[model samples]
Target chain A: MTTPASSTADNHAWLRRQARWSPYELAFWLAVLIPFWVFPTYLTLASQIAITALFAVSVDLVLGYAGIVTLGHAMFFGLGAYAAGLLTKAGWGEPLSGLVLSGLLTALVGLLVSFMIVRVQHLALLMITLGLGLLTAELANSLGWLTGGTDGLQGVDVWPVFNHFEFDLWGYTAYAYALAALFVGVAAARRIVHSSFGLSLRGVRENLNRMPAIGSPWRRHLQIVYTISAGMAGIAGAVLTHTTETVSLDSLSFQRSADVVVMLILGGTGRLYGAILGAAIFMIARDQLSDMNPQYWYFWIGLLLMLVVLFMPKGILGGLSGLLRRLGG
Target chain B: MSEIMLATQSVRKSFGSLEVARDVSIELPRGARHALIGPNGAGKTTLINLITGQLAPDGGRILLEGVDITHAPVAARVRRGLTRTFQINTLFPDLTPLESVVMAICEREGKAAQFWRPLTSHGDAIDEAHEILARLRLADEATRTTRHLPYGKQRLLEIALALATKPKVLLLDEPAAGVPKDESAMLFSVIDALPEDMTILFIEHDMSIVFTFASRIIVLVAGGVLLEADPDTVRSDPRVREVYLGSAHGH
Candidate 1:
């Protein structure tokens, strides 16, 4: 029999063989890094890509890892945004503290809501989230005294980050910060989905019956994932609010949730980088198209999403990755 | 003397009007390799479910050793050393065989909820999992994804998974079902080699294999035990022949 030393060597060699990066992949990553060094208007676009990518990644935790389809995800995102906004407008406009409070407050809300949602399945889960988001939006509207409602909570001056780095109107600091957060979030997500607990979660998804047989408490497993994914969404929201320095009730809409699902599908579910690519591609297209045809952009985006669902059910990156593997690329 | 490891006292279950399990009492003494033989629609799986606390009994008591577990959930029963495998429902498709076994072992080790520490960092659990996989002769296919494994290997993985739970009372619902004849015998040998103190109850329609391996045979007719005795007596019992052995041969 071959010794352990030889086996370990073989494994390392196999991984090395697999590490050959495609030219397109190299180019894409290089472009992402370019915004970090080059000073240009690409900063705002990069910031949008980072925040949107993080939000998409959080949504994928539920959709891909735990296998729950959500249409009311904006509730957490909006909660985070407004929580930061309200605290800042309340004469406590510290960026560091506002970000922390945003995540904490949204996490508490997510915990309460997730407990009620654990028993719901499929369309009920979607509808309940939708209703929850709508209710939150309505509260924000009625209590404009707190949320600033439809006009949005504006004129909020966030103190410099760390009491030193002032909010850069040029968007450089915001883009770099957002990109770092997204990178860390995606990397952490990758670790969880690759772990044993995550594997058991997939087992729970495949067959609820199988989990108990394997000595897993299925409901508790689902609840844990829900709570963690909710917190991740909250972080994404806090990051978005931090960069924009403005909060809008638009953050809590069914469109936002549906858009994230579209992003996940556009990149591919169950893949980390796919979420990033999907969010970037989606936001870029929507922004460019809306610039040209602001009123009709929604119709075109919807048409394209349906086309993707029909023709490329795996999402763009998912399909491309599979095609590459099949062709020995 | 054989010690009683698991006992059910007139346990009853019904799905509305359908009486799937009725007034069932079972005893699996420690070290007993008990065979539950029945024809189609004989409620063998339901009996297994009741014992493992998957479906709560409508009316009777389920005692594991001296402890009453009638109201206990399936995970609780698993923790109490009662582990079971589904005939067809169990097994995760996308994970590697090693991953599935590692998850089971993690549960039995009682620390599956730990989020920050990666599972592979736990050296002892990995070693224990390796040992369990080795027992089922699946060490060679450890890294292969579950969906890629052949049907027989999947069945082996199922039993291997149950083994990883450190079960004292093992209930297998048709462990040999859907597996080919050669593979069934291989599976039988694996079960035969299990620790002698373990109490194993399994449902089987394969009478030849059942008669060859089982020391005790319990025949279930209509959600109730018709006969519970040694294999020789059960093989010759007129009622067993009439309800079970006869129908099985009709095909």
Candidate 2:
């Protein structure tokens, strides 16, 4: 029999093997600083892309990791947007605190809704989420006084972050802010999905019937992931709201939710860095393609999406990773 | 006499008009190796389900270590050391055998809720999972995705998952139903070698395997216990010869 020392070494080696950072993650972190050097005037666009990527990652947490299909994820995003906007308008305009508050509010909403959402699966879950998103939109439309209705909540000015970096018209500070949120959100989510709780979520996803038999509190795991995902989505929303200095009904629209889901699929679901790549490819493509063909940009976007879904079902990043692995690189 | 670790009192279950378990009563003493046997549709699996809290009995109470647990949830029952395995293999098909077992071990250790720490950091759970896979002779396939494993090995992996929980009363619906004849021996041998402190109640159709491994046999017919006796007595009963074992012995 081999010595225990040899076996422990083998286990350590396996752990180290899993610990290697993917090139995608390294490039993403390094790429966060690129807008500052190359395209200072395009900081607004870069910040929007970062915020959108973080939203997609949040959706990926529940949809990809926890296996909860949702069509109303933007409800949390919108709530966070409105919360930040309202907080600033209400004279408590600390940007970081506003972000935290908005995220917490969205998470609280998620916790409450998870009672109904987690109990159902698949079609029912999708419909309930859609209904909730539409309901929130309708509420915002009707509550014209607080939400500012069709015109959006106007006259909201975000205070400079940390009383230091001023909000510039070029969006340099905003880009940094969104990237920081993404970095923290990604770190926390990566830690979570690699943990035992995350494994149990995969266990629930793979065999929900046997999860309870294995002594897992399946419902609780789902609720925790759902709530955390909601909070992350909220942070993305708050960042966008603070960056743009407005919270609009568009934040609550079905289009926003659907777009994030598309971003997740385009990036791949379970891989953490896929969301960033997906959002980047999507946002950048829409930006560039729309500028070239303002009237028929959807044509090009739709064609690209169809090709992606047809050929790369695991999403663009997952396909690239697989290809790289097969090449023995 | 050993203490009664599990008991069901006149438990009854009905699916619409069809009664699956009719006033079934049972007592499982600690460390006992008992096998439940009957023909098809005998409510053997239903009885296991009721004991494991998968279904609530229509009529009586289920007691675990003398405390009523008829109303407990499946997870609560499992945490109380009463665990079960499905007749059909149920496992995380995408996870490696080692990961699946480690998750089960973590669930048992109440560390499955630890989200911030990487699961690999729980070196104890990983080591324990490795040891269990080795015991089940599945160490070679430990890192292989369960879906890629042979069906017989999947069946053994099912048992390995149950053993990871360290259940006080392990209720196996059918541990060898789909395993090959040769592999079935290896599976039962592992079951036969389990520590005597962990009581086992398994449902099996294979009389040869049951008679060899089970110290006591409970025969069910039409959702009721027809007889409960030592394996020799059960094999020798005239009624068993008539209703179940007749003409099939070929021996």
Candidate 3:
């Protein structure tokens, strides 16, 4: 019989093995970096993909891991966008600091909102989030003097990266900045999900009733995750505002929230890589399909979503992992 | 007498008009192996829920080690050395037993908020979880997903999770509800092996398991305690025989 010490060592090794990066994961990250050198012309599209991927990861933190059903995620994103825009418009134009401040501000709002959000579940939760989203959108719309309303927030200026590289017309700096933020956000999210705290969140998602018995308060866990998720999404939004130098009503639109949900579903929920892959695939498909057939592009997107749901049911990443398992077996 | 670890004084609860628990009072000293046996809807589970803070008692006081905790939340109760297992198996189906137990241990240690470190960094928690699983004869199955485990093992996992909290009082609601007869004996054997200082109140239907494992039995009928005595006394009591054991034996 193995000694207790040896068995524990085995368990430690096994846990580390589970968290270690596989070759496929490494390849995916390498591919994320490849667009900078291999496809310079697509830098603008690539940057958007990076920003959306970060946003999708934020959604997955709540929706996929915590099992919170929300339709108003864009509230934070829009908040971040406007926060960055307003900051720049007011002359605090440093890009990195602007991003950090926007994310922090969004997190504060998320913490406040989570007090109400964590109290409800299922349909009520959905409605509260939806109402919050709409409420914010209308608040921004009505505050024409501040947010510029339908005209969108204009004259927002962003400074250089650490007083070094300048924001260029070719989108070089924007792509690099957004990609760096995505990497950091994704890494932090990955760390959170694989930690003891992350496991508790999964436990909350799987059996919320059981968490209390095990000494983990379900609502507190939900609130913490929601706040963190909101902050990450806010960062993504701030990145967009910085790159594009514009903030429109679309930032907080219901459609933006709905589209992020679709992206998460397409990529898989729960898995960090799935969110990134989903965001990348969805954005690429939108860019390509809309170019090929602008008016009917959504038709193809709908078809793809249906096919993914029917065959995979777990999202593209889930499907791929299942297939790999079968082949190995 | 041993110090009282858990006590409920005149606890009462009702769903609209149907009174499920009626002015019930029960006390458990440290290390007491008490079995709560009653017929269907006799408030056995309700009493457990009331003590564990799952449902508010209509009127009464609950004390844990002499501290008033009548209105504490479920998680707070757990953190204060009170824990329970569901009658129905409630588990994280996608997580492995090791992960579930480690998370439980983390909750107990207040390390659940350690978001920056990797799970493997908690080597001590992992070791403790493995030991707990091993104690329940689940060490081999620790790495397997909880959903795919045999029904008997899943029930054991419930006890394992409770034990992870180092609970001073464990309220188990029909822990062997759906397990096969042969397996439940082993399940109780594991419970029997738990620390002797831990107080355990379990609800079980099987008389043999109850008699074999429990040092004392509390019989309830129509939301009131019929008798609270040692196994031998409870066995000979005709009222218990008539109300519960009689009908229980008939099946």
Error of 2 at A47 (Å): 1.2
Model 3 residue A258 lDDT score:
91
> Model 3 off-target regions past 4 Å?
A1-6, B249-251
User: What overall lDDT, based on C-alpha atoms, would model 2 receive against the true structure?
Assistant: 0.88
Give the CAPRI rating of model 2.
medium
lDDT (C-alpha, whole model) for all candidates: 0.79, 0.88, 0.91
Chain B alone vs. reference chain B, TM-score for every model: 0.97, 0.97, 0.98
Backbone clash pairs for candidate 3 read none
Output the number of the TM-score-best candidate.
Answer: 3
Q: Clashing residue pairs in candidate 2, if any?
A: none
TM-score, cand. 2 vs. native: 0.95
TM-score of each: 0.93, 0.95, 0.97
- In the range B162-228, model 3's lDDT, one tens digit per residue, is 9899899998899989888998887888889889999999999999999999999999998999899
TM-score-best of 1 and 2: 2
- In candidate 2, what are the lDDT values of residues A1-329, reduced to their tens digit? 11122253465456545656767668768977988999998889899998998898899889888899999998999999999999999998889999999999999999999999888998999999999999999999999999999999998888889999987888889899998998899888888988998889889888989998988888998999999999999999999999999889999999999888888888888887888888988899889988998888878767877888999998898899779878865
